[model samples]
Target: MLRELEKAEQKWGGSNKLIDQWLENRRKLLVHYCQIAGLPPYTNAEKSLPSFEHVKSFCDLLVDYVSEGHFEVYDQVINACEKFGAPCKAAIQQVLPKITPTTNAALDFNDKYAETQDDQVLYQLDKDLSELAHTMETRFELEDKLLEVLHSKYSEHAQQA
Candidate 1:
């Protein structure tokens, strides 16, 4: 996942300020996730559950990232597509609907784990994290596709202008 993120950054790092910021948020979110999940590099040899603070922090990032994408970045992209005209607009409309399920899954994960004080919840954390990771990977791929289409079309329009 980290490797995939690095590749995404290389591909779209400076394409737009909003995207750059969103990608940076993604990087932070992933790093925090790795530490919490005990993935390598962020893992210690001893494998204990992540602290409450770590879980809470990760949940915060997760929610913030989702909210930003829905509220800010997606809006900007949609507006840009609209301004660029029909082809870009239609492509984004299709992609945005596909992304909605992932958003729901992410929020479900956050609601289940965030602010929980139960040790039982901690026991379920590992499984939930794995699921969330899968959801995020799907979301990222969709987002990348959206960005690729938008950028390519927008670039062409810009050049022709």
Candidate 2:
């Protein structure tokens, strides 16, 4: 996931300030996730549950990232597409619907872990995180596709204008 994010940053880093910020947010979220999941450099040799503070912090980021994508990023992209005409509309239509399921999954993960006091919920954290990771991977791919379609069409329009 980290490697994929790095590639995305290289490809789309400065294409637009909004996208740059969004990708940076993704980088932070992924790093936090890795630490919590005990992957690689942040690995927990003891395999203990992550600190409650860490989990809460991650959940906060999770919700913020998701909200920004839905309310800010997607809206801007769609508005841009409309302003530039319909060249990318079909691709956007296709990608947006696919993104909804991922959003629901992410929100579900946030709800499950964001403010829990039960150890049983904590016990399920590993499995839930694994599932959320998969969902996030899918979401990122769809978002990239949307961005690619929008950027290509918008760039063409800009050049022609």
Candidate 3:
């Protein structure tokens, strides 16, 4: 769960600058997501139509989160594995591919929703967003697994490095 991740980050992130920053980013992204989901239908519902701006904002945040994971966090984790000379290097590589399904699902949702030009009431998107939420949860679990192996194990290995 997210709470476990926060604990892991707190327990393990302090020593590593990259990890500390990454955890901070993760917290921000998760909080914003919760806030977005909590708004009046919940916040900033001025239009007669469903808040497409809100949808866009959420989609944008999702992209930012994923981008940071791929372009920054995952790469840092890989580097940490190598730097610590951890035996999990190969196993971590294997784990990376397992994230593809969730990544593809998210990217597909982002692409589909991003191109919509009108203020459709999002009734159709409600079901789709719900499915995307499930996919995001899957993605988070996969990410946590990576952190467990990549951070906990590798940090342990770092002592021997």
Q: How close is candidate 1 to the true structure, as a TM-score?
A: 0.95
Question: Alpha-carbon error at 148 in model 1, in Å?
Answer: 0.6
Question: Which pairs of residues clash in candidate 2, taking residues 3 or more apart in a chain or in different chains?
Answer: none
Clashes of 3: 3
Candidate 2 on 1-161: residue-level lDDT in tens? 88888988998889889999999999999999998999989989999999888998999998889898999999989988887666577678889999999999988988888888778889999899999999999999999998888878867988998
- How do the residues 24-132 of candidate 3 rate in per-residue lDDT, one tens digit apiece? 7666656655554553434545533345676677778777778888898889778767864546787678788888887788788788776577545354675676687
lDDT of each: 0.89, 0.89, 0.70
* Candidate 2, position 105, lDDT: 93
Runs in model 1 lying further than 4 Å from the true structure: none
lDDT of 3 at 126: 57
Candidates 1 and 3 compared by TM-score, better number: 1
Higher-lDDT candidate among 1 and 3? Answer: 1
- Which 10-residue window of candidate 3 scores lowest in summed lDDT? 40-49
lDDT of 3 at 142: 73
Ranking by TM-score: 1, 2, 3
